[model samples]
Target: MRVGGSEYQFTGTQSHPYWFGWESMTTENPSVVLQWKSEGTGEQHQQNYPVILQVGGGLLHIWYISPGEVWNKVGTAPFSARAWHKVELGIFARPDTTGWFQVYVDGQLVADARNARTWDDRGNKPRWGVYDSKIATADQTHWINGLKLGTSRADVD
Candidate 1:
């Protein structure tokens, strides 16, 4: 069985911060996303723990409960979910298309850099965890939702 997704464009410039929840979908990476949808299409985990998704520079910005860490984390997918990974903001140098990118897990700042690139061979609404042949079939899935592009906290803060 399969499921279709949604099409929503945020109404704002680089001055609005978008946010979503872990109903069951997040971006593949946390370093380079700008929007989201609550569509968990892909693989199956031990169970769904839900996650926050984002994009920056060109990496997926994942904000969720790392499977095996002390503190939650925000990093690229294809990673484990059980460690308190440390993040360093200002990782980039000039802010991404969304103005600037920040990383936070379990309510903490990890990395915040600047870059002008995002995950878009198709546009702003990029797809993550899309059954990559590079990985494996059993590992095909994107696990987060609620996307926010063209905006961030700094813009409103």
Candidate 2:
């Protein structure tokens, strides 16, 4: 399955390291945001996709994916998975030099790297999102709703 005019593939083992189970999108915009909730279980993991960016642009896009706990990596309240969990993935482009990128889930900052290792980090600009296609247990699948894309604060708000 595909979304946001982006293309992604599950290139890892589906049973080990929990296999990156998530979604991937190819957008021409500088930045975007996505919100999702568990469809069946409680906490779940959503992996980020690889993107490429032009070094001259100095622009960064963030991929945010949750306000609730991310599978088991986040949260302390022990939220319920049967219910809906809200997540927002933001992609940000660095300043003038265009050397690094960032990935944020919910409202918490995740990472800023010169070389990202999400799937295949090709450094492709204007293309960022989630891509988790790992089929583990009988009741395992990454699902999220309420996805939105915004360039800046105003566009998202």
Find the candidate with the highest TM-score and give its number: 1
Clashes of 1: 47
Q: By summed lDDT, which 10 consecutive residues of candidate 1 come out lowest?
A: 87-96
What's model 1's lDDT at 45?
26
Provide the global lDDT of candidate 2 against the true structure: 0.29
State TM-scores per candidate.
0.36, 0.32
Model 1 stretches astray by more than 4 angstroms: 1-6, 11-14, 21-98, 115-123, 126-128, 131-133, 137-142, 145-157
lDDT for each residue of candidate 1 in 1-157, tens digit (9 for 90 to 100): 1123555543324343443212233333333222222223334221122233443333345543222322234455323332222222221111124333455543455544333232222223323344323434233334444333323443222
Q: How close is candidate 1 to the true structure, as a TM-score?
A: 0.36
- Candidates in order have lDDT scores of 0.33, 0.29
Residue 148 displacement (Å), model 1? 8.8
Model 2, 113-138: lDDT tens per residue?
44223332222223324333232333
**Which portions of model 2 miss their true places by more than 4 Å?**
1-83, 92-99, 114-137
Each prediction's RMSD over C-alphas, in Å, is 12.7, 15.5
